[model samples]
Target: MVDFQERDTKRGLREDQEAAHEGPAAEGDGAADEGAPPPGDGEAEIDEVRQQLEERPESDGGQKAHPDESAADPGDDGDHDDHGHEDHGHDHHHHEHDLDELGAAVVTVSSSRTLADDPSGDHVVEALVDAGHDVVTRELIPDDYDDVQHTVDSLVRRSDVDVVVTTGGTGVTPDDRTPEAVRPLFEKELPGFGELFRRYSYGEIGTRVVGTRATAGIIDGVPVFCFPGSTDAVQLGVEEIVVEEAPHLAGLAQRDADEE
Candidate 1:
C-alpha cells in the first residue's frame, strides 16, 4: 500500500515541474513575437521617406528644401517679365511717331558766298542727304533782314518744304539779323533748341557760345532752324542736333496735315 502511494506522489511532482517549464517557454515565445517588426516593415519605411523627399521643393542649385519652405511666387515672376516687355513696347511705339524721311530747304545768308563757294551750305545739304532727307532747294542771299525774312517765309510756305535750315547770320555782329527777322514769323518758338545748341557748343567754342544766337521756330507747320555762318558751327548744329531731331520735329509739326 505505501509503495503505491509513493509512486503516485512522484508522478504528481514530475507533472508540476513539466507544467512550470512549458508555461514559461510559451510566455517567452509570445513576448519575442510582440517585440519583433511585421513583414515588409523595412520596405514600407523606405517608401515613406522617398515620398517625403519627392514632395519637397528643389532650389536653383538642385538641392531639396524643407517641406514648409516655398520658392518665389510664379505669378510674381510672370508679372516682372510682362512689365519689362510693356516698357520696351512703350519705347518702341514712341519712336514710331518720328518721320522716316523729310524735305528740307537750305539757305545761306552770306553776301560773299555764292552757291559754289558755300561750304556751310554744302555741309548742310550733305548732312541732310546722308541722313536720308531730301533737299528741295538751296539759296544764297545777303544778310539783309528783309531778304532773310522773305526767303525763309517763301521756303516755309512751300508744300514740299517740311523743314527750312539757314546757315548764316546767327552771330552777335551788326549784320546778324537772322534771329530778329525769323522770330517775327514764328507761330511757336522753341527756346529749347537755342538752349541745347549753346549748351553743346560750349564744349567746342567755350563761352563764345554766348555770342551765338542759334535758333529754331515753327511756321506754317514747318520747322526752321537758323545756324551760324561758319562751317564748324553748321557741322555741329546739323550733325549733332538737326539730323537727330529733324525727323521727329517735322513729323510733329505736320501731324495736323497728315491727320487731315
Candidate 2:
C-alpha cells in the first residue's frame, strides 16, 4: 500500500511538471504545443498592420483604391494613361499625358462676340469648366486668317493656356482659313481628332461634314482643339474626348512645361 501511494505521488508530480511546461494560455485548450505562438502574437501582428496604415496617407483602413483617387498610390497608373499616348509599360486604352498641363484654358474664335455670345462657344466653355478646368481667356476675333492665327500664337507662346478651344471658321468658306493659319503653328497635328469628329458628324450631315475642318494639335506646350461653328459639334468633341482625356493629357503637357 505504501509503495502504491509513492507511485501515485510521482505520477501526480509528473503531470504537474507537464502542465508547468506549457504556457499559461494553453492550459484551458486541448492538445496545445508548449512552443505555440503566444497569445500576444495576435495583438502584435495587428499592431504591425496598424502601423502600415499610419505610414500611408492614402490608405483608408487597409482598403485598396483606384488610380484616379490618389496619384501616390502604386496601384494608380496615372490619369493620363487613357489613349496609350506614351509608353507607360502598360497597354492603355486612351491617350496618356505627353504634357504636364493638368488644368485647361479656353479660347473661342468669333467676330463681334465674346464667350457670352455663341451658344456653341458657350457650351464649349461650359463643358471645359464642368470638366474641372479653367478658362484663362476668351475672345471674339473676326474669322480672318491673320486674326485667328495671331490669337492662337499669343496663347501658345505666352504659355497662358493649356488647351485652346476655337470655334467657327472651320468650313469651306473664304474665311475658313483656320486650318491654314493654325497648321503652321502646330508642333504635332492630331489627325485622328479631325477624322473622328468628322466620322461622328457623318451620320448627321453625311458628306457635309467633309466641308468641316475641325481639328486638334499640340503647339508649344498647349493642346488646341478646333471645332465646327455648331454647338452640337463642340459638344461632341468635348464630351467624347476632352472631358474624359483632358485631365491626364494636360498633366503630361504640364510635365513637359515643368522640365523646360
Candidate 3:
C-alpha cells in the first residue's frame, strides 16, 4: 500500500463538520463510565490519539489537520488488492438518490511521509461521490493519538456530519492505535463492526489478514468506522461497510448510540 501521508492528500473529508451533537449521545447520556478499551481496542489507548492533532508547522496559527510526516506502508503484501472481491457491489444500490439524508467525511491518517497519487485515498473519494452524499473536507494528520482523537471528536460533535470514515491506525503495532485513540470518545463500541469486517475481508483475502484492526462505534452520536492502511482494506471498509450501512446506522446512532 502507499504511505499514509500519500493517502491523506487524496481522501478528504465531507462537509457539515460544524454541527455539534444535537441529539442523544451528546445530551441524553449521563457521564461516560470509565472502562477498558473495547474488545480489540489495544493499548497505548489514550496517548496515541492525542499525539496526532498537536500542531501544524508553517501555518503557525492555522493548525489545520496535519498530514503524517513519514510515508505509510502496511508491511503486509499489497498484492491482494489487485483483485476485487466477489461480494462487492456498488453501495448506492438501495439509497434514495444517492444522497441519503446524511452527510459524511473522509480523513486519512499516517506519518508525515505521504505523497500525491495515492490509490486507496482516491478510491475513498470516488466511492463517497458515487453514493451521492455531500463530501465537505479532506485532511491529513500524523499518526499521533491526540490528532486522531481530536479529529474524531471534532467530526462527531459536528451535527451535520452523520459519519466519519477514517483510514489507517487500525492495526496492532506500537503505532497502530486507531481503536485505542477513538474508543475513549465512543459512548459505545460497535463490536459487530470489527467482527463483520474481519469476516468479510477474511472471505476475500483469507486468514493472512490479521494485521488490520478495523472497528466501528459512536462518538457523540456520530458513527465512526476505522480501517487499515491498505487500499484493499479501505475499499472493503467503505464499500461494504460505510456506504451500505451509514444511513440506517446514522439514524439509529442518533437514537440509541448507547447500544452501539
Candidate 4:
C-alpha cells in the first residue's frame, strides 16, 4: 500500500508538470501573436500599395492610363492633330472663286521705252504667263495722258482681255500721268490694291514708297493694275500682289456680267 501511494504521488507530480508545460506553451504562442501585425493589417497594406500604384500617372511610368491613349476607344492610335477642321468642302472655302487662269494684256507707258526697250513690260508679261495666264497682247505707249487713256480703254473693251496691266508714269513727277489717265476710267476703285502695293514696296525701297503713284481699279467689268516703270516695282507688283489676286479679281469683276 505504501508503494501504491508513492506511485500515485509520482503520477500526480508528472501530470502537474505536464499541465504547467502546456500552459506555458499556450502563453508563448500568445506572445508570438503579439509580435505579429493585427488581423487584416498585412493584406490592407498590400491593397493600399496597389491603390497608390493605380492612382499614379502613366507619364510617371505607372500602371495608370495615358490621357491621350485610351484602351476603350480602339481607334485611338495616339495620333492627335490640333488643327482638325470641319468637313473639307469647296463651298465653305475662304477663297470664293475657282478660276485657274485668265487673259492678261501688258501696256508700257514711257516716252523713251519702245516695245523693244521695255524691260518692265517684259517682266510683267513673263510673270503673268508663268503664273498660268496668257499674255494675249502687249503694247508700248508714250506717257501722253491721252495715249495711256486710249490704250487702256481699248484693252479693257476687248472681250478676250480679263485684266489690263500698265507699267510706267506712276510717280509724283509732272510726266507721271498713268494714274491720272487710268483713274477716270474705273467703274470701281480698289483702294486696298494701292495700300498693299505701298505696304510691300515700303519693304524694298523703304520710305521712298511715298512717291509711288501705283494704283488699281475695275473698269467695264475688267480689272486694271497700274505699276511704276522700274523693274523692281514691276517685280513686286506682279509677283507679290497681282499674280496671287488676278484670278480672284477677275472672277469678282465678271460676276455681275456672268449673272446678267
Candidate 5:
C-alpha cells in the first residue's frame, strides 16, 4: 500500500509541472488570436490611402505622384516667351524714330563779340557738324532781349531748321536776358535741361553753377537750347548733352510734320 502511495505522489508532481508550462503557452496563443488584426486588414488600409491620394487635386499632393501631367505645356511656354519678347520690343520701339541727321542753327548773344571772336559759337558749330548735323545758319547778335528773341524766333520758324543752339547772356548779370527773352516763345519749357546742366556743371564750377540760367524749350516744333557763353561750358553742353539728345528730340519734335 505504501509503495502505491509513493508512485501516485510522483505522478501528481509531474502533472503539476506540465500544467505550469502549458498555462503560459495557452495564454500567449489567446493574446495573439484576440489582439492581432485580420489577414487583409493591412492591405485594405494601403488601398484606402492610395485611393485618397489618387482622388486629390493636381494643385495639392497629387502633383508628386504624376510628374509628367504637372509639367508646363509646350504651347503655354511658347506663348509666355513670345509675350516677354513683345514687351521688350514695345519698350524700345521709340528708338526707331530717332533721327540719324538733323539741321541746326547756332547763335551767339554777346555785347562785345562778333562771329570772328565767338569761340563758343565756333565750338557749337564744330561739334554739331562733327556729329553729322548740318549748321543751317549761324549768327552773332547783341545781348539785347528783342534781338535774341527775334533771332531765335525767326530761326525756329524756318522749315530747314530742326534745332537751335545759342550761347551767351545766360548768366545772372544785369545784361543776362537769354532766358527771359527766349522763355516766352517756348510752347513747352524743358526744365530738365537747366536742372541737368547745373547738376553736371556743379562738379566743375561748384556752387557758381547756380548763377547759370541755361535753358531749353520747344518752339514751333523746334528744340532750342540756350547755353552759357564760356567756351568750356559750351563744349560741355554740346558734346555731353546736346549731341546725345538732339537727334531724338528733333525726331519727336517733328512728329506732327511726319504725320502730315
Candidate 6:
C-alpha cells in the first residue's frame, strides 16, 4: 500500500508539471499568432500602387501638361526646374501692373470711313473703355502714308496718350502703307506682336493671313499697335493680343523711357 501511494503521488506531480508547461506554451503560441501580420496585408499592395503611380511615364497613356504649365499655374511655386526654366527667367506677372488705368488714342486710317461709319475704330474705343482705359483722342485720318505718320506722331507726343492703336491701312493693297508710315517712328519694334497676331489670324483666315501687316512698337514712350480695317481683324487683335498684353507692354515701354 505504501509503494502504491508513493507511485500515485509521483504520477500526479508529473501530470501537474506537464499541464503547467503545456498551458504556458499553448498561450504563448496563441499570442504570437495574434500579434503576427495577416498574410497578404494592404501595406505591400499600397506600396505597389504608389510605385506604379510614381514610375508611370507621361507617354504611357498619361496626361502631360505644357512646358510652361508650371509657370502658368498661379498656385505653383516658381522653383528652378531641371527643364531649365528658372523662376526669375520670366515674369508672367508683368501684366498685373501699369495697365490698370491707361490713356489711349485711336487712329482710324481709312479715307472712306467717317467716325459714324468706322466700325473697327468704334470697336477699339469701346474695348479700351470697357477695360477701364481712357481714350484720350479718336481720329479718322486718310490712308495716305504722310497723314498716318503725322497723326501717330502727334498722338504719341500728347501727355494723355500712353498707347496708340491704329486700325486700317495694314492690308496688302496700294494704300496699305501703315507699316511704312509707323516703322520709321518706332524706337523699338515688338516683332513678337506681329508674329503672334499672324499666328492667331492664321487660325481664322488660314493662309491669307500672310497678307496682313499687323504690327506693334514703342514710339517715344507710347506703345503703338496697328491692326487691319476689318471688324473681325480688329476684334481678333484687340481681344486676343492687345487687350491682354498692352498694359504690360506700356509698362515696359515706360520703364525703358524712364531708364533712358
| TM-score for each candidate, following the candidate numbering | 0.69, 0.59, 0.58, 0.66, 0.70, 0.64
Better of 1 and 5 by TM-score: 5
Query: How high a TM-score does candidate 5 get?
Result: 0.70
Candidate 6: worst 10 consecutive residues by lDDT? 30-39
Ranking by lDDT: 5, 1, 4, 6, 2, 3
Model 6, position 184: C-alpha lDDT score: 97
Instruction: Pick the TM-score winner.
Output: 5
lDDT (10s digit) by residue, model 4, range 70-158:
55668877778765675667554745653577889999988987888889998999999899999999998888999999999999999
- Considering summed lDDT, which 10 consecutive residues are worst modelled in model 2? 93-102
Error of 2 at 102 (Å): 4.1
List runs of model 5 lying over 4 Å from the truth: 1-88
- Model 4 clash pairs are none
Candidate models: Cα lDDT each: 0.86, 0.73, 0.71, 0.85, 0.86, 0.83
For model 1, state the Cα shift of residue 238 in Å.
Answer: 0.3
Q: lDDT tens string, model 5, 129-237?
A: 9999999999999999999999999999998999999999999889999999999999999999999888889989999998899999999989999999989999998
Candidate order (TM-score): 5, 1, 4, 6, 2, 3
Give model 1 RMSD, 1 decimal: 13.0
lDDT of 6 by residue, 46-145 (tens): 5676677778767525567666665467866877668754765356665444667889999999889899999999899989888889998999988999
Worst 10-residue lDDT window, candidate 5? 27-36
Give per-residue CA lDDT, model 1, range 127-185, as digits (tens).
99999999999999999999999999999989888899998899888998999999999
**CA shift of 235, model 2, Å:** 0.9
Cα lDDT over the full model 4: 0.85
